[model samples]
Target: MYGRGGWARRIERRLAWSDSFVIVVVMVGAHAARFGWDPLAAVAGPSATPYWQVSVSVAVLWALQLGWARSREPRVLGHGPKEFQRVLIASWRTFAIVAIVGFLTQWQISRGYLLFALPLGAVVLVVYRAAWRKLIHAQRDRGDLLAQVLVAGPARTSEQMIRRLQRNRRAGYNVIGACVPGGSRARKTPLLEGVRVAGSLEDTAEVAMSLGAEYVLLSGSDAMSLREARQLGWELEGTGIGLIVAPALVDVAGPRVSMTPVEGLPLIHVEAPQFTGSQRVAKEIFDRASALAFLFVGGIPMLVIAAAIRLSSPGPALFRQVRVGRDHQLFTMYKFRSMYVDAEERLALLAGQSDGNGVLFKMHDDPRVTRIGRVLRRFSLDELPQLLNVLKGDMSMVGPRPPLPREVEQWDERVSRRQLVKPGVTGLWQVSGRSDLSWDEAVRLDLYYTENWSLASDAVIVLRTLGAIFFGRGAY
Candidate 1:
């Protein structure tokens, strides 16, 4: 566990075994449902084998495809969406191969069986991966399964890296120490809070060994050159310590970036974001369909809430305000009136006590908030009326935060890009830190989501919204 790979190998082995077990179960289950108690049941074509044999073959191939696709690799195992993305890719390719083989050999595969096995296997595999991820997170939270690291870079970069890793401990990186970039010119004293400055960059590997660190992270900044990086790699060749470069490029989605090795120099290229395409169309269709179903379920509750609000406060039950939508278009955003009718009139008087991200107005306990309004805001029931906005094509189920024009007027280049996609009732901002996020961080999150929008990510944000609401962190 203290070796270069740390606890990753153990987790990988467990994943491999469990993946095989679940794949086999889904395959056999599909076959049994389609052709029960029929190991010798003839298939549709002359070249086709028995249904049981075909199921076995497909199961083996599917499991192999998953491994071949490297879906269970250590880097992707415990964090982010890459693990789930690769699972889908592997499943799709496996079924595609089966389809091609059936077409070529006239082996009539059962459409129902394929449909059942594919989705079932995919769901099971993804859920299993998610379960493992949760276990990894729990283990890390318990101070186990953590990969100790020695960061090598300038003081500022090392501190930033350490803080980020420490903040998101679910990623499993534990920075034990750090080394500065310059040789003797750099000070060895601890400059960072709670992190010791071990030595210079040239002695990074030695420091890593002395500290028993499993990984060495090199911050790719101006302090390190190509020769220095290569030399460091050579020094750590036999040391059992993994070297990783944290490139200055940050916060963009992984799918938009690619690395190419051109004559031993890794050139990173970022692809342009595609805002209009089939995916956008799919997002729209999904939004409206899901909105309709949600409205069906929440219709009565919304009426009840409206009645409650009307009884509690002498104001209209619904609040309508103008907000910026995709491409900077204007739209009327609706929400349950969670404040008194005179709330806006009292805004200027409370400006000095604003608890928001500066650009927007927010207060945890404002005098204008009705008793029920506070509860509604806490659970985010106040945003329920935006489903009508989604149905009216003015909003989405998940996208950038619906910004008031007052906020948009203060936009920078990054913040302006936030409106490239339609605003949402709940967004990365809602799931991330809500009103507690700084203005810059909030804009950055919105910009990232707008540029890297995906149906899968949208769904992820929506699911996370449930937890965000439940925890009620930074909600106000």
Candidate 2:
């Protein structure tokens, strides 16, 4: 626990140094470009303020704004989009203030200098933070620099929380022990394989202190009242220990969740999912534009693959199949032919030999795949034709997986929610594990994306998809 705090402080210091360096470089560069290197001679009109002095002041204020924005806060440092968003907001606000001040004081600040420095500094700062985060994530993956947590809840809820924390190592939570309602009496009993009962919920703070825990996570099923929770919070005050209440909401993004205090009680507000808006229009525009651009750039390679398929297989170069799209609309999905002409007929014989999760049919060595087709599938070159689907408005660059018609037939209402968004050529499930994911896990990822779709998230998925294809992760 102490180590985690030290690590966070180390990261903060590094970020501060990086931010200062970037600000100095950008400001100095902008000043030199706008005015000559002679600092004393580069004076503003009327005010006679030296441009170098203005540069120094702006640099100092930019650094201060980053701190004021809480961009270096431990809670947001190592994960999620909040850290980057905060940094950007802080930088923007600082510039806005500078502009307003310049106008009122008639300082005659160089617009070119301001414009150049602002964007360059922001980009450099964000890149520096991302590099630091990557290093931290690498450390955490090896079980270092993680917060030691004591979970206090019902056995079932505690178990679930432990599993989730274990699965997402990047979240940086390491569950050391659990304290249930009657955990004191079962101190020797194991809650999960390695996790043990630390103490009862009443002794949560004590248990956490004894275990050197940095956080006490309370599950929704914990038998503690709000008053008791408050008392626990008070007890742990000044101990460098924090309390986390695990709400029942699952698969929700941070931007959609808000906390409001009413009558001294904290109330959580979850915004309803939105499917149609200007954002949707923006996404559609992006998809079509990107699809058209990629199609043009990839035309030569796609034609080469088409020729290879023609020579290796007896069937057509392109294969078209029916897939269920957004709002349960059926569309003709296109792919390069990867299977033998009789592969569909052979499915009946190989039905019992499937290595895939129950819904999707997959085989590691299906014998039906042509030699060229194997290479195409491994690198996802077979899906190049989907660019046309994206251009035609039948798909997106990133969204839920395109489901087969037969698979949709077995979906319950919860699973069917994936149809709320357009299908994608590559998505969370594709980059995450592809064929390695079970049907339930795939559905969960798809549903999560359906509910929390954003252009930024889509951009992230697109970048990850390229890496996944290059490495052939979970590809047969």
Candidate 3:
């Protein structure tokens, strides 16, 4: 019922207000800390510009930089890394400009003030943006604050797009209708379960208008020619409807894509994925060092867990299993035993009752789990010992899930891509849905991570894993 432009404007206004508030807080706090309550008097500086004047100027400049940077634009709003990156760039540019001006004009700005304010303001702005994004995600989850879209493409492509949009609700797209190659005759056969067939490609604009669509998404298989696509764009020019062409590339991040115009045609160039470099070496060192630090920090609790497991079950406190690591190498992965001594013996009887994906056996309430073991598994205490595996260089702090030897043995060419990176104590699969995910979904996420691994993304997954563990959402 809400207009897309109106919703976007509302979010933009809120962001603007929050940005101004953060800027004011950072500037005023820095001023007060450096120069105390006196506004008229300048601290020991060559220039005698009033502290209040300087604060006001800095705040206004910061807000202007944010606006000029298009940080609040709808395209980068709600989700993706672009929003944060823009905010950071804007903040750094503002500071750099101020530094240059101060240097040239011989205006003595307090070094302590600049140092304290710049980093504090940037961090506060990013935090505020993240909080706002969380609120937007919650609204989108409830089917609010989403852009209505009409999918125009072949039946297969439309269906795939709908499924993908459904999977990522935070992307803020609500598919309202579909316009395939066929006309109304194809309406009898729905493209997606809820998405209605509006009309053919020729009637896309009309269909989008009727459905109040903000955007028309053209999938890869859409039969519209270049001229026809251009005509469609022209028709929607005055209607405030945007056209988007969905490329065939899957699991490609924006950073790896570039657009170049050649002979009046926009050509998309995708960079090949890189796994080995200085970054990989740094990641390897980081994984082992962090693991060593965690082991030292959690040593006492691990010992207590081991003692509890030994007392609860007859088997050894620690459980060692063969797992496939990077390059298909085999390694002994350790975990605090969270199952009874006879758990393996009883697996055959419960195999048919597995409540997990076909490839991974899991149960919400398994009889093999001891009382103490259940507590340990619930909070992921069982995974604490994997820090040792990470320290031993056989695993990482974040990567694809460490697969059992049996699972690796059954891997096809597609699933084998996970072996390109070292197994991890936590990963996209762990934070996403864990035991609740289907085999294909799990594999898809793992491959996505494997293909587009970055230190920033790894840090994000590690943080989300903590939240998932605390909430105990999809854990067995």
Candidate 4:
């Protein structure tokens, strides 16, 4: 019943305006920072063009490039790293193009100006985008600005799609109805409770248009052939609606997927995720280096935590426990002791009263936790000692959380795949929900991280970990 992205367009317009303002300010600020806001001060060279003029060009070009890059696409607007990636890509390419043009023309562009503007602008733009995303997510949580969707598939798959979409409201897909392959009995009947089948597969386009759905998903489209699918697309030509085919693959990251046209037919290919070679080497190097950096910064705070632990509890400040690492290797994990000296010995007696995720042991207000231990674990200060574990080559800065040997013993074959990479002090599981997530959900997140490992995603997880630590939710 709503126009396509009317609310989205409102947000996009605000973003475009903000993008211009940010670019302009950064460009002028860079020039001012470099040349001291002097009216007559040109660039670095004598008889060079005024940096003020150059700033204008860069600002306009950068904003234009962002638009051309489709960084404001509604689908990528409120969620995922794609929106940020596009913004960064567009900004980088804009400067790259500017550099090339200046070089070809033998123009004296101020390196200092660019050095300041490029990084600053990129960071600011992304930060602003993140702010916008937060706002969008807040609205989505309130059931605002969602794209109305109608799933067209078999009854089972349509229900599946509806449920998944409903689960992730942050992605902004609101499935209002569906078009399943039925002899009209399933029609006017509840597909999955409140979500009913609007019509049959053949009526997908008309139904989507009638319902004013923004998206029509052809999930499990076994009833439709290639020609019929195309015809459906043709039918929705001027309706301002989009058609998407829900590929059979799930939990696969974008980098591993590609569509190859074989004789006019699109064939999707999924590459197996590699955990070895250059990527692995790079990850290891980054882990150790960052761990060292963190330890340097956190040294004093860690000492204070350790001292507090010693004062609060009779146990030694630093606690070393055995944990499983890469390839099922046993490693001594480090932590600031947050529990009493006899906590482990008292575990069996308190086992049955465990308020854990079934597989793990966690108590919100555990008697074993000392006074200072609550503060330490709440902000993850207890885990800071694991930086040494990382540097000792026993762990990574980002990976599946190191599991207890006993916990590992109970895992299934799929869960055991976590051993393919080194464990981390913090991970997708911890960031998602520390002690509150179900065992199955936690394993699913770990496996997802294992299969879709990337430096970018790892950085994102680490950032999210900071927020999780600050909030202290589900972190007993």
Candidate 5:
């Protein structure tokens, strides 16, 4: 076990060191290409040091850059672009320092070399970091270099966390088991499925040491006081085990979280959700312009699709279904007829064989779907008519996914929160897994958007949706 742990640690260090080294190598290469081998030879002619000395100086400068950035620290890895940002800052800082020193000392350094090297360093570092991250994720999926965590929480929260982690295995958390605070319950739940009970809160340390847990996660509502938590931390100190506290706040975005220290107490503040006034105006303008442009530029494609539907199937080219929108208002959602006109009539007959969630009916290979319809649905061409809905002020450029009236009727109370703003043609759900998502997961994404809508976020979702549609992920 110790050998395996040491190997994981070594791999972590190598990834960081190699990334910094590769960045420096590219920077030096770009500098050499921009300015010839003897850039300073004009001023220091015949008295210049050997070429190897110049290479050694560049290597020293690169090492200094890595030290200044602290890129080797493990705290900033695996998430966020902060690590990349720091590397860029360090590279630029090195260039500026060198340039200033050279100018002050009247040393003849090549401006051409410095200019090319800085950008080259940035591009190379970004590319290398992305490639390495892909490799790490691939290995993680195979259960390599993952953290074995023991959850210390209520049975319900622990069960939910385990299920979520299991569903997204690439996240790299292997939940070994749970340590319920009040001991196990008689009524069996999925909580203890394939997991041994390690003991209650008082025996946390014993369980941790025995199970060889690398990390311990405390659920927010678990029965542990601040003092008790501190004691637990002290006990686990110097054990190479990590402690994570799960906050009670759910579906909140990073931008919405603010930590303030007042009188030596840290308090977390959550901002209210608002997508109105200037934001609403901006969304409206965006929708109107995009809708108009698509309608005009895409007129030919729309007409051709209409003709194909008419030829392949004997029905109107367009299909309209009632959908619930903002403020619980109803609007006619438009799409190309992917099924026969009597699709609704046929739905009842196929109800028992429905492959969709209990609330939504879907079939992977429904006989009602025509050849042209399947093609259109694959690339999401059928969703084009909804652009008109956006132009009509019935929808925004981006919001929660639009829901059918029947689906809306089955939604939980919190689901109605999505109706606080107009529905959209694409949303977080569409960009995420779309139809592949469980009903609960879909609702969670929609609620997250509703409770934390931002103009920047909307723009990002739209861009991601474009890529998702082209790739046809989670689309039948």
Candidate 6:
């Protein structure tokens, strides 16, 4: 297969060049025909002012603005709002320059011409981009526009990179094969299905060239020397191929990755994960403001839930459990009781029937779950009390998963690091797969968040959490 990104970049450059030419010609023609040329001739007679010069200047400036805004950046071409933003920026910058020139020279610029030209150019640009994006998206829908990437790294890292690319197709990567730097001892050419081992890391560049790969994705901690890697970049520099570096750090959220150039080396600094701090302060402020507003708004529903629980079961409406929080502090986490009062007492009998992963106990259909409790858990009404906990600073709107002391005690050294920040009512695990996640996977996600938290990441998690709660996947 062809290398990843090669085809995509080629298409982007072709479209950009063609579109740029068209936009420039149309802008120049529109402005001169609509306003400048006739008026300049009317004022200057046959002597003629330099109208063509001004028109050419405007066209050139428009083109330069497009380039400056990187309206043609391959990575952002077919998705997100960045592409549109760039187009708008380019058009507005060109318009501003025109306005400035008219003011400075005291030129009789027609208001109708300026108004019509700006909007028309913007509309044409957006239309062309939208059409091109649609075409590219259609190609992706048919799995035709993908760039076949060659992943070079150790066996495991290569495998992980391949899987990650396969999972996120919108990123436009297609992992065709892998090259293990040290070479694998396996007799088979490929350790995984559909992935052939092209060569060792020492020959990574050669493999990429031979395969006509569009992109080279690098992984591994020690496969290639820095000198060899630099040489590989130099070899691929003019080859129209792209190089991507994938670090060994797994599950790192994007905002946490920051590059600081210390001397000549680009050192990556990962910030510690905390949902509170400034983000928490902001969240808390929102939560308190919201909770107070919601208590009045949601008070009726809260009362209804309480009444339903009281009438359905012969017990209190709320249940509080001892949960570990930030700094390993113990707090009583309140929730609408979803299990009978004797659920904990009955845990000993259900030991053999435990459905949870070793440490955490769960049963898909527990005998202790009250009828009303089942409904409460299904829609996550049980979590509403935690909003109060959030208001009180005992929990957050988003963070790592809160763990029980027993579960915390069973954690290995790395897992215990989750306590470095406050726990959340809803977190990465809650939004990811919830009860469906294995203990290991859940711990991994929570720790991943604990090690790389951000307000934006928290917002994304909370947004996803809302969807998960609505879908009720793995919630029971």
Best by TM-score: 4
- The segments of candidate 3 whose C-alpha lies over 4 angstroms from its true place after superposition are 1-5, 31-44, 48-52, 105-115, 292-317, 372-376
Per-candidate local distance difference test: 0.84, 0.87, 0.86, 0.85, 0.74, 0.77
TM-score of each predicted structure versus truth: 0.85, 0.86, 0.89, 0.93, 0.73, 0.66
Shift in Å, residue 270, candidate 4: 1.3
Off by over 4 Å in 1: 1-6, 36-42, 183-188, 272-286, 289-316, 339-381, 409-414, 454-456, 459-476
| RMSD vs true structure, all candidates | 3.5, 3.4, 2.9, 2.3, 6.0, 9.0
Candidate 4: regions farther than 4 A off: 1-5, 352-355
- lDDT per residue as tens, model 3, 204-270: 9998998899999988644877888878889999898888889888887745689999987788898
lDDT of prediction 2: 0.87
Candidate 5 Cα errors over 4 Å, as ranges? 1-140, 182-190, 262-265, 285-307
User: Largest lDDT belongs to which candidate?
Assistant: 2
Worst 10 residues of 6 by lDDT: 39-48
lDDT tens string, model 5, 322-355? 9898999999988888888888888888988877
How many clashes would you count in candidate 5? Answer: 0
**Candidate 1 local distance difference test against the native:** 0.84
Where is the poorest 10-residue window by lDDT in model 5?
A: 43-52
What's the lDDT for candidate 4? 0.85
Indicate the TM-score of model 2. Answer: 0.86
lDDT of 4 at 422: 89
List clashing residue pairs in candidate 3.
Answer: none
- For all candidates, what are the clash counts? 0, 0, 0, 0, 0, 8
